[model samples]
Target: MSRTKKDDKPAGWRKAEIIEAAAQCFMERGYHATTVDDVATRLNATKGRIYHHYATKTDLFFDVHRTGMDRLFSAIRPVHDRGGPARERLVAMLLAHARAMLEHHTYETVVAQGVQVHRFDQTTEGQRQTMRDLIATRDTLEQLFKSTLEDAIAEGTLAARDVSIAVKVLLGGLQWSIFWYRPQPGETEADRVALAEKMVAPLVAGLRAAD
Candidate 1:
């Protein structure tokens, strides 16, 4: 949060730093166990620094959720938009999604946990609206996948009697990584990409249309 005139960055940059720190704390400790002080310490800043940008821990947590959804849309939208065979496009989108999950591991994990929080009645009345907005964004992401799957089915590139159920199974396979994926020491981006490919292959194979 400290910036001299020479080193000054925009408020947006500082806020992003705080959100990333909060994500790490939430990923490591879970939301209930994580404190504003935990996020502050992770950034080597004071509680005032975080409170300056966010009035409450819930506010900061929601920002992380928002950012995670933003990241997912950004990462996969290009692949979704590109003109290609529907099956191929679906495969590319899945890879993009899996890579994003690995690359933005902390944010994705925290966002995943945040989704589970809705079932527990954890958010206040004011916060529930923001939670609803986040859920809408999450739904949009799912729709992106669903529409592509529908296209693939129509094109005879994929097989699914129920597109909605298929989309859930496909995304669920990718999302389950947030619960169990632990990066190994000295792993490179290429290593993660290779792992993602390995993870995505079976999922794609399962959905491929019969010859």
Candidate 2:
């Protein structure tokens, strides 16, 4: 017997839908304001489906945040693993990061906003375990950025400033793009690439040693 089209969806599709809906809810309403029912309502599905995949609203939100971080790291992971000139690799990583931010704008927005309102300490021990997992996932991506910056400095592509401070500035600037960057009707990825290159070029130049 042939399966129906709906039944033909890959196993992960349903979970992806739930995460997408939850991300939208968290973005539209603040994290504290959003509930599992809100996500189910947005998805036009029952809460059971979500509960099947996530134990609580916090768990769902944590998955949403993890999804965003995973997208970011997946995009940069190739450049990070590739052997290349440090400057070239750094540029590749920055461009990948910007593209990921644009593609996963909603998830990224929720993550930026939710971190301010959500606290792991409020959760039970099990829930806190989930929170720690999410934080570690986020920190891994951050360490990738830090490692890239350090490599650039070591290669003389960037100056010998504190890697921690440099990573902060780089990530802060990249994250703020989610807030203000509105693409015009005819805007292309090339346009965004050019803009990103322009924004980072001067900073990179400033980091070069005086000769």
Candidate 3:
């Protein structure tokens, strides 16, 4: 059944439906190969319907990337804000990120490819500002990890040769889920929860303070 319809809820809701469908389409076909028509077909709508919400495919692509960032930013905010030992808190944040990637598989996967997507072409100043806002959100999230890494070093919990590099490595590890993770047959959410736990164990172990 079609979950996307003009009257599903309201204008914003319909726009979101288009963004999500566009994200999945872009993820599957690559941005250059996807069209506004492809996005419309995904929603069981027409070119006119998609064009009504998004002036161009680039507009929809940016919205898809922005939505993915917004989701991860929101999902991890609680863990990011809570005060705790770096080891404990960082692991919690990483697991939350991994879970968001799995839950929002298509959007997050497209977001994970931002570097390549940015190479496509330049946009108008307004669109450029939208990208800047999304970049700020990403930077804020990375800063949280860098701060926690510093905190860990100060408290003698985890030691890293270079905290900035460590932040990238740790974040890259979490983003790796976007490329490789898929539910195995018969897997449940409980199973993914366990996978997150198991995955983070080695992560913390590797970061442990020497001796």
Candidate 4:
């Protein structure tokens, strides 16, 4: 069945649908190589269907990148905001991040590439603004981790001379999973949960202060 209609009325699901298709195409073929036709082919729809929502391929790509950042926020922001020791909250946040890496694999994959802004030319004002906003979002997420790390250091749970480097090391480990993690065919959420826990323990312990 057609998820979109011929009428001009907006279906709220249409935009998200297009973004998902675009993410998959970008993930498989890369942003430079993927075309509107490629995304349409993935959706089993026509180019007009995608064009209805997004005027250009760059707009759709940025939307996919934005949606990926949104997913990361949804997964980790609540855990970061809640009351707890900073170490515990950091652990929870890292676990949540790892799970997001596996669960929203394609979107996260696109987002990782989107971080390399120098590769793409943002010629128009709108595209430049979108890149600025996306960079701000990335900084916000990193700051969340930096704040948590600072708390842990102040509390003497974790010791680090440079919080900035620490943040990069921690997040870099989790982010690298999108490259090497090949999910088993029959794996469940439970499996990913276990892997996330296993992956985070050593990372957390490495930063622990001497007794």
| Candidate 3 worst ten-residue window by lDDT | 1-10
Candidate closest to the true structure, highest TM-score = 1
User: Candidate 2, 32: how far from true, in Å?
Assistant: 1.4
Compared with the true structure, what per-residue lDDT tens digits does model 4 show for residues 82-172? 9699989999999999899888899999998886643665547898789889989989999999999999989998877798888889888
How much RMSD separates candidate 4 from the native structure? 2.7
Worst 10-residue lDDT window for candidate 2 reads 202-211
TM-scores across all candidates? 0.91, 0.83, 0.88, 0.91
Whole-model lDDT values for every prediction? 0.88, 0.78, 0.80, 0.87
What's model 2's lDDT at 144? 81
Tens digit of per-residue lDDT, candidate 3, span 141-165: 8898888878878888776569888
Error of model 1, residue 66, in angstroms: 1.1
Q: Candidate 3: list runs displaced more than 4 Å.
A: 1-8, 184-186, 207-211
Q: Is candidate 1 or candidate 3 better by TM-score?
A: 1
Candidate 1's C-alpha lDDT? 0.88
lDDT of 2 by residue, 7-119 (tens): 58786998999999998898788788898999999987789878998988877887888888888889889888996877778777877777777667788987786566454
Steric overlap count per candidate: 0, 0, 0, 0
Window of ten residues with lowest summed lDDT in model 4: 1-10
Give the alpha carbon lDDT tens digit for every residue of 38-141 in model 1: 99999888999899989889889999999998999999999999968998999999999999998888889989888667776566888999999999998889
Clashing pairs in 2: none
Clashing pairs in 4: none
How many residue pairs in model 4 have overlapping backbones? Answer: 0
